[model samples]
Target chain A: MKVVTKDKGVYSFSPAHKPVEYVKPGELIILETEDAVGGQIKSEDTPLESIDWSRVNKATGPIYVEGAEKGDTLVVDILDIEVADRGVILVVPGAGILGDSKFEPRVKIAEIRDGLVLFDGLRLPMRPMIGTIGVAPEKGEIPTATPHRHGGNMDCVEVMRSARLYLPVFVDGALFAAGDLHAIQEDGELCVASIEVEGRILLRFSLIKHKAPEWPIVELDDHYSILTADEDLDKAVKLASEQAVKALMRAKGWPFEKAYMFGSIGVKLAINQGVDPKKGARAIIPKTLVTLNDLLIESD
Target chain B: MKVVTKDKGVYSFSPAHKPVEYVKPGELIILETEDAVGGQIKSEDTPLESIDWSRVNKATGPIYVEGAEKGDTLVVDILDIEVADRGVILVVPGAGILGDSKFEPRVKIAEIRDGLVLFDGLRLPMRPMIGTIGVAPEKGEIPTATPHRHGGNMDCVEVMRSARLYLPVFVDGALFAAGDLHAIQEDGELCVASIEVEGRILLRFSLIKHKAPEWPIVELDDHYSILTADEDLDKAVKLASEQAVKALMRAKGWPFEKAYMFGSIGVKLAINQGVDPKKGARAIIPKTLVTLNDLLIESD
Candidate 1:
């Protein structure tokens, strides 16, 4: 397996960035990713406010997936996420869901051992997940700070190990990149940060030809998570739930009302991160109720 | 166990209504609830639009708790929810989160048996939950169609069997009422309807002396869910997460930043229902992470 090192990090996902590594479909590779803060605040002794913002969210790669073309779906099976022994979490005063609340800058370094995140005096079971992962957009570029149609920085907890993320291919070769790993994170990520850690992601790339859902989709153990994002949380919820209903209608050959009614009883609309510029919303539908093919029904 | 029949239903929760049923603390009682449509539309035979809108959301009782007072917290332990054999689900064109979407008014009658909701050629596991359950507000009357701090029509799926719901008392006797049992429902009732069904709710009432959470708090088997509502989802998300962080801060004697950071990695902010007049949002914190006392730390 080829390892894409952390030195090949990109600040933004763009078609302008040339591919640093090339691999054929079904080729498994490892990408060494840096933390969200570029792994700069090692122990939090440094002031969080003075850190260079430009160096933030540095993602590793624009790994070219051969045979992945525009209008195709890039299938990335997340096999495993191996994290470092230690990670960092910080609370910046003006940078979270509760940004207006009076709070000083605080930081904590956590130790990962025996499958638990040892923080302060509490031990939480490790749930390592990828926070930033996607391909180039249709036109220009999307910064690693925002998530949209091309799936950047979604911060969805369901993007963990054993999940398969399907991204809409906008540019040829699916200029794929991923970074910002979290050892563990809650659903909303209220403070805009989690147990940010550097890790190596093991994933295999494949392609679904000429068929792609409007937004990204992640297949978990028992459910399909429709990842959709918008600046407005209400709009995000609309997009996510609409996609689920549309797909279910297409799958079962049911009319609009039947699909809409089934969605009310079957799909869960959850928030991924409310603090992000493009707040993440997901529709979690059980595999027993919906399938990968069902979600791709709107393919053009 | 004493049973409170379905005929004692009220269209709105109010201090104006006289007590219909009275019970001592820790006394188990059953409230036989009407469907959301007040059992008007029995099956697909009746035209959905033709139903009497005036007779909607008929909840059962003003079950007065003997010892519950204005300053105390009324503890309601949900023993069991026995749903009726048949339930109806309808999609109205001008209602719900996707209200603007082109859809016809379609009704589905689901059969409940063997712990399964047998729908249109599909068998789904039955998970019954309460949709409208609350006490009277401090001053004015609130219709059963809207949810607020007083907790009406929340449509929260976690309000299911085996969940202990803690509500804040406003007036004497804690004038409690509940109805709108859903045979099964997703997190966000996007279509404004689930498997709308009538059911009997078995409950026991108790009191937490002079202490109450600002919003409703439900104790599930593994986690404590803080239910909050707002006209705007962003505000609801803010309220839910703020309560979680504030409670955690008071619990472990941690300062602002520490609690904020912990919340990002621990508390899950979930959307309960977006289609309601007041959208429901909840912060789901694991029991091992934060106790019920931690959440009630702000009580005076």
Candidate 2:
């Protein structure tokens, strides 16, 4: 077990360019995180006339997982989250999907009180979840705010407690970094923000070899989730459906057409993320009616 | 209130097509309903090899609401549901989103025991909600299975108890009919079906003269919802965003651009329906973020 702190813009223990050592499954690692804005703004601070957008959204790590190959899945088991006295603030400028002209001089502040995030006289149950948690993509550095195949900024609420997130290991060691904690957020976070806050997160990581998905997949207590993103909701849904069908096919060994038909006839589809315009849509196909054990998987 | 029953594909009612009427902001009305199949299939009966598709979704009646004019909004308040001994069943074949392929023969049976619908091995908390409740469309008779401006076959689980559903009125009397009760369902009944059953429903209807929206709007406690459907998810989301902007503009008299901007900066979106291939997407917007009080036409 190891503990690390991120002060200002520097990490207490910065790793070199090489891959960091891996920690086995059920190992506890604690990381103290900063607010999404990196403490640039305070509670009494007024809305910025012009924000230094570039300085925001800094992730904490490329913490390498041991033995995690390209095709393997990195299981991030979120153990617990401790919110700081100060939380996150959300601002929507002119560049979002609704565009900029409609919202102006908008600033909403949330406070963590009695285990709840209070915003605009509404008491949202404080369900601390990560705003951005993912691995590095194969190419250039992907912005922490943008969600992609590497699972950045998913803004998915169900990734909260007791959920095991299985992310595809794109690069070796699966350079993992997580920050931008939210006290509470709806699925879309339509207003483009949630109760963003600084927090301490405890996560347990495990590596599964030779078991990587083309995209990320999640398995919770009662449901299985498939994540897919596209600039278009239709295309995104189609991609998600295709992936879900493929998962079903692999799990059930049913013919492709039969899997598709079973999905159409028995599965349930849910929209996971839609507010992020860049990654137009994300859907989840839950194996609710059909039991996973009923399907016989034929090894590839 | 009127009582009706169907036996052997034949129905008899005390008040037949006599336009059941209620006022705006009225209390819940209890209606005794028949199954979607209209008694064509029974508890012991097997799935029909060929269901009369036309007759598969026959609803109870066109209950005309008093003072509901074209362009007005009808608020249907679901109160409670009481399922009978035997419920409904779903069979997938040539119809549905995956109509292109054949699936294995699967059957699910349901029973109501002590206010719970026991389906398979799960005891789903009975939250009786309508699967087909709507006004007559401006066009010719639309099937009970398809949803349109009239709000037919919405199958939205949130439209249950304590939720207020607003339907845009098309015809003079606002011919409202409701049936196809379900015990429970997720956001998208990806199986293209739910725990469909025959149940007694209690609902209250009210009318709002000048508050009719361009599309359906639902209010569940503090959250507001907008339903949209298109050939694709992007278009569907765009349509939903546009509708949400329109609702905000109409309610707050903000400029269209401002509404869009406000939505971009402040709203949250959720997928309401995805089972239908033709139209699959629903977006939810919070009323608190959008300044609706500015356009308040004498608040209720």
Candidate 3:
């Protein structure tokens, strides 16, 4: 397997960026990712004022996939995410929901050991996840902090180990990058930060020609989910739910109303990152209610 | 044990409503609740246009608590919820996120059997929950379809068996009423409906003088959650997160900023009912992170 280290990371998603490495479709890769703050906070005593905001969310690649082209789907099967020994979570003055007026800056460093992230006396289960992953967009450069169709900083907890993330390929080579690993995070991530951490991610990549999804799609053990991002959380939710309903309509040949109703009865709308510049929402449809064979396009 | 049936159901929450029954603190009661539409749709073939909009959401009581008074908390420990044999889910025009623009009025009937909801060959696990539960408000009457400080149609799935719901007592007697049972529902209930069913609810009541929450709270096996409802989903999320932070600050004697940061790392904000007129959002904090003894005010 090929290995991509954090030293080769980029801070933005752009089609103009050259690939750091090239690998064939269906190849496995091990990616070493930096924390969301890009290793700036080294200890609990590190001052939040000393950190550079411009250097945050550095993604680990634009790993070129051989034979991948525009209008195709880039399938990244997440096998494992091993948390680093130490991590830092910082709540700065101007960031997150409470913002500057209500909250002063603070930092907490956590240690990963014995299947838990230790924060003083509190021990939370270690659930490592990739916070940002995306392919190159169509034209302009998008900073790594924003999430859109090119899937950046989604911050969804379900984007954990064993989930398969499917990204739409807008540019040739399907330039895929990922980083900002977290030890654990609750849904909504209301204050805009989780247990920010560093980690090693293992993934297998494949291409589905001419079958691109409008937004990122994640296939979990028992469900299929579509993620959408927008400034308005309600709009994000509506967009994601619409995608789910479209998939159901295509698969079951049901009317839009029936598909929408089925979504109401079975699909779960989850908040991914509520405090981001582009907040994200997801519609998760249980696989038990609809089979994989039905959801995927037959022509592909 | 006393039993209250749907024959004593009311369409609004008001302190002036007479109590259909009375029970002392620590006494058990079994209540029979009608569906959200007041049992309007009987079968799959039932016309969506026939449902009377004015008669919807008939909650089954204003069951008076013998000793509950103003400025207190009415504790209702839910023991069990047995779903009825059949239920209806309707998505009508001019309702839900899709409303009249993208979706047409439609109805679905699901059968409850063998601990599953049978819907068109798909068997969904039976997760029975109370869609509405509340004490009468202090002021003017509020419809049964809206949820607020005096909890109404929260539509939260966690309010099921073995959960304890704490509602604020604004007036004397803590006139409690509950109905609108659901056999199964997703978190957001996006299309404005669920497996709307009737059910028998078993509960034990208690009163905590001068310790009422600003919103409804639920204590489950692994977590404690505060539910908030508003027309703006973002505002609702903010309100719920604030309540969670307040609880954390009161519990650990931490400053507001530290408590808010703790909430950002550990508390989960979940959408309860997005399609309702008053959108619902809940902040859930894991019990492992904070003990019950620390969260409750001992002075009460």
lDDT of each: 0.90, 0.62, 0.85
RMSD of 2: 6.0
Query: What share of the reference contacts is kept in model 2?
Result: 0.29
Best-fitting candidate, scored by lDDT: 1
lDDT of 2: 0.62
Instruction: Estimate how well candidate 2 is docked, as a DockQ score.
Output: 0.24
- Using DockQ as the yardstick, the better of models 2 and 3 is 3
Candidates 1 onward: DockQ, in order: 0.84, 0.24, 0.68
lDDT of 3 by residue, B177-240 (tens): 9999999988888788898998899999998876677888899988988899999887788888
Off by over 4 Å in 3: A293-300, B293-300
What does candidate 2's lDDT look like per residue over B130-167, in tens digits? Answer: 77767776656666676666677777777776777788
Task: Please give the ranking of all candidate structures by DockQ, highest first, separated by commas.
Answer: 1, 3, 2
TM-score of each: 0.98, 0.75, 0.95
Leading candidate by TM-score: 1
In candidate 1, the residue pairs with backbone N, CA or C atoms under 3 Å apart (3 or more residues apart, or in different chains) clash, namely none
Better of 1 and 2 by lDDT: 1
Report the error of model 2 at residue A179, Å.
1.9
Clashes of 2: 17
